[model samples]
Target: MNTLIKQFTLFVVLTLFTGMAAVAQQSDYQIQQDFRTEYNELLERIDQATTTEALEEIEEAINDLEDEYEQHADLIDASSNPDSFDGAISTLRQTHASAVESISTIEDLNDQIEDLETEMEGVKSRLDQLSDERTTLQQQIDASTENEARQASLIRQYRENIEERNLFVSNFLGELLSKYQSMDSAQQQEISEAAGRLEENPIDVIKNVINEYINMMDQSSALMAPDYVSMKAQHGYFVEVWDSIGEQLVNTFAPENPAQTQEEVDQLLTAWQSSITNNLWGSIRTSFSENGVELAEFNSSEEFFNALNSYLDGSIETSVERNSEEDYDVYREFNNFWSNTVKAEWGEMFIEGDILSQSQISAIDMKLDDWRDEAMPTSNLTFILLIVSIAVIIGLIVLLLTRKSGESKA
Candidate 1:
């Protein structure tokens, strides 16, 4: 009976042990199955992710999976039946990291593009406001025709506003140029396409600004009484602005045809220069004619200076030979011409526009000063000659009177 009891006890113990082993084995199999299922789901999610946020969430889930199955790594590897859990996890981590990095780069590029667009919009808004103010000031100038002072004031204000607007545009272009040069090819292309989509592309804005300046120049050239001083300032400002962006404009279009783009830019600059020359010379000719100084049409600055020098030399020689009071009036007239017309009206224009060198201006000034010295003598030689003649006449009268007295005494 004791032997029978021992056998029953052995059977019961063996049965409980087998059942427990089966349960533990089943639990490990479930764990492996759960890990695989989650891992596959994560792979799909990583493949489909298009944003950093989505990829980050998937990465976190992957980390959790790794942590949860860390203790059962060997069992999970065995359950894989030819694939190790660790190898798969490594691949998943690599893929997840790559996805996250790619998505993050894309997001960063998109953010940069957005910032550029916002800045462009702000520039457009400011330009629109300036345009409105300029229009109002122009209207005020036109309506104040009866009040010359008011008209002049309004015109000055209008010009100041234009200068401000142009300066802002130049600075904006400079900043954009720096930004464009700093960008990678991909970012550059993206920005170029985006700018092209706007109502006015940045290239078109540059072109339009140049065209507007040219138009203003043409208007000034056409005027019977052109404001040469103001026109000179405006032209100088336009040149400065163009110099800042002209290279960028050419580079922007260089991908298509570099030579043609360069030719077009050169043509625009030449037109600007020609307009300035025509306007200044036309006004000078009119002023010379009004002042009784005959000035012929000149094709070049050298020709103009030669003709002026010759005329001044001839006038000086004539004044020296005549030595009359009329020459003094001529001196005053020529001095006024030099001071008000040559120096005041056109000197700055010629120098700033690079039409004439400083040495050329200095040479002209020296010639004018020499002519002034010759035309108006400081010694008063005419007065001295008159006094000597009077003394001779008085001496002759005294001798005649003394001879008459001797005859009366005889």
Candidate 2:
């Protein structure tokens, strides 16, 4: 009876051990299934993630799963059938990494775009200030009397403001161009939409810049004492800006008609040149008349130069007859008008502004030199007359002395 009790106890013990083993095996299988289910869910989340925050959350979950299943990894892999647990883990890690990279790129692009928008706002503000200041300075110039020093000072400030504004524009454009070239089509479209929200489209900004430059040119043309040096410098800067950014702007906004845009710009520049030329000619004509040099109506610069040459010829002929101090004063006045007013002011401006050629200026200078040589008072004739009179007086004294001596001797 004791032997029978020992066998039953052994059977019961064996049964308990068997049951525990089965339960533990089932538990491991359950853990493996749970791991796969959670990993697949995280993968789905990664696929659906749109933003950096979402991607980060997914990456954290993936790392957590890796840590939780680290010890059971071997078991999970052993139990896995068609799709290996190791493969799924690798896929989740790789997919999560890819999603994070993509999200980071997008976020970086957005940050850059925001920075550009902020910069654009500052640029706009600065440009507005410059415009206001220029207008005020122009008003001051117009309202003030004809004080050359004050006018020159105001004009210098105006030009400095213009240069500052243009430099800002150029720097902004360079940054924008770099960003634009780096972007893909979708990114470029996004930027374009952002620019629209700001109500300052890049193309429109370029157009406004061109318009402002033209308006400034018009104002210069209307000014009584136009700053030709400033105008030429500004024009050159405008050309450089246009060359750098013009094509890109057209490509971004009006890709279909680049040639038309170029043609329009050309026409505007030509018009500006014509307006300045006409105004300068009108001023020259008025100045000539004020100086008592009557010039007929001239159709072109060539015709005006011809009339000028004729006047110089007539003046040179008259210069030879100048003998008195009053005559010298007249010559000095004409010479001062030519040197100070015409050559120093207008002629230099004409050459610098490309209104006249160097050769033409050289010809005019030669004629002026000839006129000066002939008009300047000389002592040669007076000295000759004085020497002849002295010789005649000495001869008469000698004759009287000789006649007295002869009479005394008789």
Candidate 3:
């Protein structure tokens, strides 16, 4: 009975020891897995770090991971699994490499930021120099009262300097605004202040530009005064200015301009409509009335176009015979103004159903086509004359040669 009891006690004791041993081995395996998991997470964070502070945080985590890894190193080394030991060591090396790469990235970003700061400083310096030069030039321009040419030269220089400075401001504002969101609070505030100092409101710029165009057009009209040839050239110049101003208006509201807004764009469009109606259309109508094509005489668009074509084709033909180069130029200017400007207005009116119907528009288009076809014959008139002149010269030469041959035979 005593022998059986001793055997049973030994069996129970051995079983408990075996269970404890298994639990300890499982616990070690869990600890190693946790370390690897933590190390992997640190590596991931290192790769994603954008700032010095973030990198520093990742560095601390890496260090902690290393300490934990060291604590388990002996256990991992003693474990029967060679793969577990190798994996831990390999992960440690990978974490170090990740940290080094993160540091390099941070350094590179810092260098880029420094370079940008330097470039911006240079721009500000140039801007200041230009402003000083402009001030000095303006004083010179103001002092030179009697010498018109010298004053003009000084004014031109002043204007050029101002334009350069303004261009710098525009470009700087654009660049700063684009990078603003990526900036820290302090950097954003600094850039915002700088941009505020330099930025011109796009709406104001557009208004000033349009006003300048209007003034230029008015001046050109005055220069046209009584000279028909100069009127044509000036009209052509005015058209170019008008088109260029329209394009400038579009660019002013472009996405790149920081001050562009929907309300401002609407105001600009309204201003354009008013300017076209009062300034451009009014001026053109006045000019036509002065030229003897009474616009009021034609109630219908058909009558209006017919009278215009007749004046251009028939009435102008006799005048062209006595016309000089200047007259031809004036005539060409009138032609273009009629085709480009007047026709544009007419088309708009047609679309609005204000003056012409769809049928009327089509009729006028056909009439204009027929007129062009008729004008084709007139276009070839010069060529026809050249051919006739050549034929006459050849006949005269042949007659002279025949007479000389007959005389020689005699």
Q: After superposition, which runs of candidate 1 have C-alpha atoms over 4 Å from their true positions?
A: 1-18, 50-59, 79-93, 181-187, 193-199, 218-280, 284-294, 299-349, 378-410
RMSD of 2: 10.6
lDDT of each: 0.71, 0.70, 0.53
Candidate 2 residue-wise lDDT, 272-360, digit = tens: 55654555566667777777766667646687778778877877787777644554566577668767877786665566555556787
**Winning model by TM-score:** 1
CA lDDT for candidate 3: 0.53
How displaced is residue 73 in candidate 3, in Å? Answer: 8.3
- Which residue pairs does candidate 2 place in steric collision? none
313-409, model 3: which lDDT tens digit per residue? 5534644454444444445555555566545634553334233456655654554444443443444557888999999999999999999999999
**Clash count (model 1, backbone only):** 0
Prediction RMSDs, each to the true structure? 11.3, 10.6, 13.4
Residue 57 in model 2: shift from native, Å?
A: 5.7
Q: Give the TM-score of candidate 2.
A: 0.64
